[model samples]
Target chain A: MKKNYSNEDLHSEQGATISGQQQKAIVCNGLTKQFGSFRAVDNISFDVNEGEIFGFLGANGAGKTTAMRILCGLSYPTSGEATVAGFDVYKQQERIKKNIGYMSQKFSLYDNLTLLENIEFYGGVYGVSRSEIKIRSSDLISTLGLQKEAHKLVSELPLGWKQKLAFSVAIFHRPKIVFLDEPTGGVDPVTRRQFWDMIYEAAANGITVFVTTHYMDEAEYCNRISVMVDGRVEALDTPANLKKQYKTNSMNDVFYELARGAKRADN
Target chain B: MNSVEVINIVKTYGEVKAVKNVSFEVAKGELFGLIGPDGAGKTSLFRVLTTLLLADSGTATVEGFDVVKDYREIRNRVGYMPGRFSLYQDLTVEENLSFFATVFGTTIRENYDLIKDIYEQIAPFNSRRAGKLSGGMKQKLALCCALIHKPDVLFLDEPTTGVDVVSRREFWEMLNKLKKQGITIVVSTPYMDEASLCDRIALIQDGTVMSINSPDRIVKNFPKTLFAAKANNIYKLLQDLRRNSEMESCYAFGEYIHFTVKADDADIVRISQIAERENHDGLEVKQVIPGIEDCFIRLTLDSGQKIMDRKK
Candidate 1:
């Protein structure tokens, strides 16, 4: 909640330099997660500042999700130290869980529940009082312009609306950080744009957003991005800097250049 | 000769009209794209043409054989990859490929050259169960299985929907190579960016074909003066721009909003003035080209307007 570094300071911290201010919402040092003989996340290190949208990118087999699971306290890292919201991942995973919100590629909400009920359920799970849930649910419905569909089952809604509602419910507790994994996979462009608008709103309100997406255009929306290839962070910088670094005009091209050279597969 | 043809194909399920009088032709050796969002009738049309399902009306053919009368022949000449993963997950990669090849009364060595590029990517893990493969590897294996028979035509439905960007690009490259091999390929994808990789793309929505042309022609046909506009408060900028009388449709595109104006340069000045009035700082606007997705949206919106007008 307190600011100890400017945006420029965080940008400098991203490229291999740490100031040790403990101001980052997320800090990873030598993080590794191995499965059998394969290292899914191999000694990755990075820092995500408060309220910044950090884009995590990689191919399908790349270790982005392993690292994310470690950060969210869902999976134990094989080795290395990491702190999320100033709580140690290994020792204070419960604390880390309480402070972070996660939205997987699949919507975590119950499809049969009504919009308001879904909101109430997630808010309750996050320990919000019933009285506060009423006010927050109504505000969320109005904010998303779902007043008409507020009582409808999530299954009856369009894919776009369901995704938006899932996102709103994910952040119902107003966690300090939110992890979004491919939040707009199959939606139309107009709907994808609207979802990104929701993301921008969340980030603007000081929620540290860590998102992974396959859409290169969406990658450009992030404040900074870290790309992984074969379980290593092959590139980390702003989208513009990445484009310059790879000598490519688009993020799609940059991704191809990094991922094409990787020899590992089926691990 | 056309490798595939659909003439006024109409398919329905109960109250839902999945494919409404859709028709298209794929020339031999052509790589065609069926581009649209979810439930756009891509799968239905593909099923009809591939002889897996019957059409309510009209006709379709593959390799000069009727879908109804020559269903057997069509099935033999065309390979299909359904939207969902259909490979046996419990089976090893080698087993799945060999099974597909045997189903067609062929062996892996018989059509090895057809799928050599893709098969090699997953061959190292041939002994591993298909379930253990990653999303990209599974995709490559599914593609190899489809090509093992060396079908004259291939139909893929949303093959790269959930795959990462790198794999999506590689899949397109493989498609291009197959196209050079003279295999008529028709693939569907929800990602609009992949539409550019096809020689020609058919933009469909609500079971209706909105436009069918090269990606460049579709972009060129967008009839509005498009602009990419941005301000400090992007959400507010969108709200303000939508409320402006001179503004046409406006939607967010990445960091900026892609919008259209009523007239020419005057609209830019008006937009800047509106941004200033709304207390938006660092306002900027630039002329931008429309992509296939943008054109698809505009076409669908116009079609909706026409339908409403007819009802009125």
Candidate 2:
């Protein structure tokens, strides 16, 4: 099982004090994915420590979604190697699928389905026990404040509430690592703050989180983040160090500094 | 003349109340903003204000014309670009601008000077299909189409939501230029930091006004002393600080925790000591300016609506 970690811890030691620790949950080496003439994910290499909320950031076409898709075994990598949960992504895709949960950028719950039904469908498809799903669904709905809305259809709920509910369902199965693509894109600040709290709780409970977001502010929430630009990992570090290196006050500026040219260069 | 006003306006999509009893006024030539995340009723508010959709109840007047009764007149006087790129994707840049201008019973060449700054950048790509252009170009073209009519008021809903930083900055610059030309503008955005650019904003959430004031005044209203403290392990530091009895509330703020101390609780000495005891490395502390994010965090905590007991 992975242990949860905040961004500060991974940043403290800085500069590779501990490399190849046995506890590292994810390792990527020369990972590359290509689509004919276009390279979606170029030669990128990084490791996600056990239970760390790793943030993947870039412009709209920076290949962030592609990298995560490859990690989750949803797509094939063109070259290089990645070991998720210590299993080779290419050779053990089925094993990776079994152990990981994925929530897409458009992870809209079945709108017409009741909250409980949505949870049951995801759990049932994942093969979680009926008893476990029942117990877990109740705990999740309560924590996310969906008690009154549990019986309501997802389409009827407000977008913020739906966002929280979707996230809750994403992690309900206790997957070793959960990959989220822009989970907080269009949510209110209050709901965003609450969503981060849920993420903290998940990390505390020993679940590794890999998330992608364009909202630079949300980048502050990750334990460690990597800037993917034009199919390459441009910068990967704790938020503080990245800000220092980029000489910027906010992640918005840092992202611009990293992505400004690489983005244009790619196109 | 007042730019726009809504009186007890109500909008509903069947049983759901997207915009509920909303009312606000935008003075002439002012940059008023409707700030909220998705489904905070931002787009719906804009649709009603721009006269795209009629309010179910109450009244709205844009440039002194009713949105329902005087919609054709109101439509002739307002420039609007929806949240999505609603321009004709099949048309070229020039064609789209000309089409919009023709729809308003005008011509782009007649108002080319007004959109000269934005239209010039994409004029070289005037023949490019709207869909073939890059995100930034698409935004510029959209602005051009909206400006072709040279309407007295402008309504932009989440124009920067999906664009890159460079493009977003460019779009804001265009808005500033348009504002200077005395075109009253009401824009909506989910990003709080952009609130500072507005003359006044209604910080909304869940379809209710949280606060309405300039960004500077809003930040000035944030109560309590804030500090940015960081160590080697920031995650554990937050968990550790949140548990410490001395601090009132501590949450992650960018590179450090934007924490507020309990009144008369303890000084900075005690705060650093707690951090040090936890072996938080390189712990640096500073007095920093409160930003929109800080104000937002304070609003939730100071509202006295505690969801759960503070972990302290």
Candidate 3:
């Protein structure tokens, strides 16, 4: 069963609606994105709770990134409405940007800038105070074991270190929510585990996390995950529930089952 | 004759010890996995085995040839796909495959049967540049190139990573098929679930092996009466449960909280009433079987993280 929220709690957040508030961390209705004849993200709807670690999952081109772009205000929905963090994605994208931190799967840290400079530049772009950026940047740099590398160009750092530092910068703003599109793609398991720990720490401090990954095991990490196929959220709920519902021991099986089902339906 | 064998291999960079005294073996036609999280020396181990880097110490042999002394021969005979996408970006799909095959002194036509299934999927885009292919297609092309030489052993380092999920599944499916072809596959991944897909896995942490066994046996060996419980304000319930003296370790597992208690304690029945007292509605608690993640958690706790249960 999905977590049922009270109408009052749903509407408690500022400028939020009760119908969409129950699943308010993210609310998308009839969301669709099309590139000419191809529907990148088909019409879909789902609600993410106030502080849920919602997993936006799919195979490559399964519309996972496309859906994320729409929700993140990076790309517009073809014919639907989406409100991210209670701000309309289309009009209040700036507000949404301020309230959410994003780490693209290709979270490319500039090779030319030192760790500190990259952090400073991003912080400056976000209109953060110079003093605040410096303080948080150093603390984050140290936490990620990049103190020595802070003075070195990001290109000089290893891939593992680059990934960790990227994560620190993404959430440096302490946004209400953070979006990670395959943030741990090539990271080692230990580092990925550490990354998940950081995600948990952020969640504990009341930050919602939205992530997309191909690894089914990582699906087990999200509090709730939605599997997109052919542009619709075919399955949604906790990993356990979805696994049990599909009678599959793993999310991989669930994905195959739904994908096959979708194909059969299409034919 | 062992297909792959190593003794006390050590690799390091500067003051940091990337790999320390690591050794393992892979039998001919066997699918072996070097399972570890990032920084667990997986990449270093792969690099050493593939002969891309020399070990500071220790010795290794593949197909009866020494990894160091016969490094060039080994390079030509083994397939190596690094974690990151490494291919000629300017080359087209067909060109990339042909180039790799030619590099190994072979032709794609000679090994056409080997990569036919995979290549066919992207053949329509044979003229598409390697840089232009989708993540999944790029993965297929890379695999095709790696297999073009029909190597005796295959080394894939997080091959499915960065690809879409559907493609990831397809890739694993392809690997399974290759295993049937008598290819000795040595793959590494930080993903625990993928670890299970291998014939046998070595769970490495901090440059040490935690366990080496089949996935089923490993989960079966988990020694804990794991239970999943959750209620209204589930996170709060987890915190409250951890404070309880009966609980041993309480972790948030997806929608529910996975917990363990002292084995002898029959006070497990107290969860519902406690939830009621905490003003939690419909507290659902049930005993659950352990999975790979569960095994990992217990392993972490065993190594001394001190996970506690909720108190009354």
Candidate 4:
């Protein structure tokens, strides 16, 4: 597949295609996760289109993490029908894990390992052939312009470089979907832009991008966004449509409007 | 008198210079910010002023006491909240608060008014273990503990990092209330939007200070006229704009591409014309005022260029 599709092609395709006919990368129907009495995820329903850049947003304690864990097949939902990459999240969790990549700000790469070594390790863990790992790792390193520093310890690289490298490694095995949780936190503005560019490239190549971020600007970059409030998806739509519906000019305002009334102690 | 002062501070770890000749001062009762991303020396500087880590060279003072000579006095008069949650995770919220107060040789009752606003929010979880609290509650508890003694100055390192937007806004509001109580606040954050909330901010990056001024002045001082251009295909528009010889810089800003031109008299028409030549669909261009993030980017790039020039 050619990775040369422009943003126009992506947007036009999204509007032209009937979403019902398109392949669903993720489908959550009445997904509920109950921890004793409290419902962390309260019967949420949504569908993510294949290759779509889906933004999952919520305030603290809004159940975004809990719902994401359920969809990622890490934790089972209490009552729901969901499928990730055409595999049931409940019964086929192992298969779902095999088809997905996950990265979070707190845990992404190994500080002790060198760049190439980390890639080789992850590639091996994902069951990629050693020969293929060698070829792809080199290509990844050169593409990120890290050929000179590829042998240096991951800890020695700047935070921005580490994040970008971590992202590349996460998607290395050619997973069908990638889950990114606050991937650009603490990165500078310039590097943050570069990171989004990498995300765009990934989406163009047909990898479904499921990301969560606190940065409102990043929320605007997604093809569609779902805002969780008090364990319920209060709003879900394209950025432009959300802004229009909320009678606001920015996504920040739209979020504030929906989230300010949240009764959850913002825990 | 200034609440905090630093002169020619330099900290290093082996080959890496964590802080290089950094200097800044925070006025009494002022909300001053050290705005920078991670690894930009904000934490190192915070550690030096809070008397946790000694700088390799140069001196700093907190609450009019020398960090080196009168570390005890400074430690007693200033509260420091490290970037990480430093309270005992196993302890309940109330236990953590009382523990911090006792360590400061003060009672929570003595400073109830100082922390009442923040503490009340977490009071419901008073018996819950610190580790059990959610992210927002943890932050509030940390703030309460830091203020339990009613210190003259407060140093918060990345209090809002990784926090959601709503919680971040609420945290800033709490800071504003604290400022009104005449507490000198010296906080650091990686978010540029938060810079505007501070009375003045020092934009730091890569072990150096880029600029220090009021957020308004910093935005006003942007050297180039910025234009925000949007099209149906923002990625293609970005690529096309980058290729234009007249464009100085082009980067995605939300739904639009913010760019500056090499020409001094660049206008909206010229920007639109350039985008039109690229055959962009639904193209729109407008002159927009620069924000603190824009200024920070410009300063960082200029400083980076200077370093390159020196290397040559």
Candidate 5:
């Protein structure tokens, strides 16, 4: 019964019409990316509803980064169709970039810049007006309670504080969608929770959240998750439904079940 | 005799005390873990014991040799894989592994059996440049290089920080194999779940050791009975739970909120009543055993309170 329900959920959105209501923030149909003879992203299809928190999970070298890059407009797909924030991945890459925020653990805010300065720089880069950037940045600094340290260089702050600031800066322009790639990689447990609360807040405010993480517990927090193995999405469903289908107690088991059979080694 | 010993080691950089009088010991052939988040001074402690950096005070010994006085001897007896990828990016996988082997006055053939299980996985890409390999492949090669010398002790810093679940599980399995060979391994990781895999762990935070014991013992030592609660809206439930005066602390843990109450004997029924009063839908609450993360969080909070009290 659970298997049938999951299959229905997966197929219900595929090739579904986008009406005035029930808008989708992202839509991909048979998306494929090939490099020479290697297909990094096999024919994959999924849709993320507006204001939904979607988790994109995969093993190392499973083509998750490639798929994300195509969706974020950083790279073009070899074939198949994908649209982000109602903009085409191929033709409207610039439009997609303008409406999305991207943050990765390896790269986020500028280290040399002060907290306030980093906010202003990212705000300006997103095309927010100078006057608005001024007011919002101050409000942001106070909201984060970094008032005394607002002028201090970002490099001086602890890892937790830097991550929070980087996240706040990513969404400063109020982009429609935010992409976080392993945002809480090495963050402390408490700080990691605080970061998730920020994600929850962003989702509450009608902004779509698309994230990738290695923590299986975090996978349970997503409204729906798609697990990729060997460039193919092996499972896509709500955490509860996936668990029932796989007869497991957690997302970790579900992932191991699907990925264990993968012929492609992590390379 | 202990394979590694750190006696009140203190390391500072200018105004920051990166490692504050931290001390721990690892038994010979034991899989010990230094578990903490970033900037928790795991690296500083590892560096001091590995003889790469000198502690401002205190002493450390690896393989029965003083870290400071017998630095060269300690260096030769231990293998260290830093947090960052320190291998030569321009060098091929084979080149990097062979170079490390030669540096330690050994060759790949000399200790081929020690690294055979790990190196064989990446041997297919032996000619590929280190930079060209994928993240998982790079880590595998790094492990192979670290083991090629067949050192008596191994120090791995955050080896699985960004690795996926499948790869991480595989890595742990490999570690277990190495342990059977009688090589003392000390690994550091931000992932709390990995703590249980170690024979013993030292939970460090803010440059101090919070606790050191087997994972089961640490979890068993949780001072409060924990509860896991769920509702239709987890975030709303979290906010509502925090507002309740009866609750001492509440944090989101995956699908549910794991919390503790101020009063003793706070069972599932009492927590359910609190959630229902908040007008939550589909409320479910139950008592659950604490994990390493829960213990870590509780310890960190307690230490933080201690610091606040000291200031007062």
Candidate 6:
């Protein structure tokens, strides 16, 4: 069920084909995004390997959202090159959008829509066949233990349940990559763990998971992490290596050490 | 006397019970935390205590004023930073602070010392619009506005939810300083790590109070001998350990898996041996001190299971 898009045959003409067969899911080279005079995202770059859960960490106003939007092809980068799921962020945004799933910091599902209706709507948007949608929707609902509340409007669900449903729908299209922006903000620790479980499941199924979160504990779960400080990647490494480098036991300490040294107060 | 007391308060919205028979007391000038997941009634209880929402039953008092009867006095004497950002978006940072100060019949300069540390960080950007400020700056501004009145108590509902680690730490540091000035502080957050920063915390779940204690005491009271187990193929290790009859409960904890032994006498040696027998490579097992989060999960699960068993 895990489809690997590493093969050259799947490469479209919109982006440069990755030469090596290392199968990187996302590649960025000096990616930069600027809003007016402020370089919200300075020259920054990183690669996300297939099936790897990449954790993007930063303080508020640290340009994480800007870089993520650029990577997701929602916004254009000022300079540098990046490819997502083998599609150019600049030239093949349509193809990239079709292949990527995104869950934002805020709830994305329609509040008035029932749980089932929201799932069906997203399925339709992704062009999932009706028969496939039925099977997948049932599977998702069951997996999230939402069978009893399937007909309930999203507005009526608890915050944790809504988050779980939003995540389920994000990956409903079976995209090769999924982007979660602070998916667990204000969520309880138990529900946060459950959300990470979903992320692990998605990554295990070959979907590259890219997530940005303020919770240091959640950042530790990622296979590799990038800490953006003042619009630049202060460090990018395994949580273990980062901890060792900073001589800290927790990701919270590591993030504080890097982010506190930031010279700019506003970004 | 308790600075804040919640006596079996219950709040309901139609069929959903947002806060159910919740009772607690916070000593004056103590930094108290109401910790829980979202929809766990932390906000509902805060609303009741802050005099924003009236409880359907029971009663709560803040600084000797009944929440229902002295709503006006409570409103005047308490500073509240709602979980969501609620500052005037169009007003400049300076303007927002001045406006809040004026509404309270005071001036920012009059109470400047109270929020000096927090306000100074965003002071350079005072001219920036509240909506235009970064999340950290906006929070600092919000805190400044909340403190400009120099109230006797502060009600901060999930103030650090979206704040970055550095800013979050700074915000708590500011809170500690404020506490030293003899102001009672009640803050709510979803982050269990932040629970450790509080003097005492009330863990809430499903609209019920699960436990209330200091963070260290809560961790000290964790009933299980928890082990931090890690190995290559960590997910597979989780599955293998779950099959082990000696393992009581296992849950993923970051890079390592946290599991408790079913038998009280089982030690790390036995756990490592099991991992070894299962052919798990690079097996590392260590007895680790459980944090506030571990305590929270255990307590919440125990309560949930108890309810289920009673239903059965």
Model 2 misplaced stretches (Cα beyond 4 Å): A1-21, A263-267, B240-249, B261-285, B300-312
The digit string of per-residue lDDT tens for model 6 on B113-220 reads 898888877888889888888777888888889899999889999988877889889888888889999999999998888898899999999899888999888888
DockQ of 3: 0.25
lDDT of 2 at B255: 63
- Which parts of model 6 are misplaced by more than 4 Å? A2-20, A264-267, B305-312
iRMS of every model, one decimal? 6.1, 4.6, 8.4, 4.9, 4.9, 4.9
**All models, RMSD in angstroms:** 5.9, 5.5, 6.5, 4.8, 6.4, 3.3
Query: For residues B8-113, what per-residue lDDT tens digits would candidate 4 score against the true structure?
Result: 9999999999999999999999999999988999999989888889999999989789988999998888888899989899999999999999999999899999
Better of 2 and 3 by DockQ: 2
Order of candidate numbers by TM-score, starting with the best: 6, 4, 5, 2, 1, 3
Among all windows of 10 consecutive residues in model 5 chain A, the one with the lowest summed lDDT is: A1-10
Clashing pairs in 2: A7-A223, A8-B234, B232-B281
Point to the candidate with the largest DockQ.
Answer: 6
lDDT string, candidate 6, A172-214, tens digits: 9888789999898877666677777778778888889999988
Candidate 1 CAPRI classification by DockQ? acceptable
Candidate 3's displacement at residue B60, Å, is 0.7
Per-residue alpha-carbon lDDT of candidate 1 for residues B221-266, written as tens digits (9 for 90 to 100): 8897788877766667877777777766777776677887666654
Ranking by DockQ: 6, 4, 5, 2, 1, 3
True contacts kept of each: 0.55, 0.36, 0.32, 0.59, 0.68, 0.61
The digit string of per-residue lDDT tens for model 5 on B130-238 reads: 9888777888888888888888999999988788778889999999999999999999999999999999999999899999999999999999999998888888888
Off by over 4 Å in 4: A1-21, A265-267, B305-312
* Docking quality band of candidate 3, CAPRI definitions: acceptable
- The TM-score each candidate achieves on chain A is 0.90, 0.88, 0.87, 0.92, 0.91, 0.92
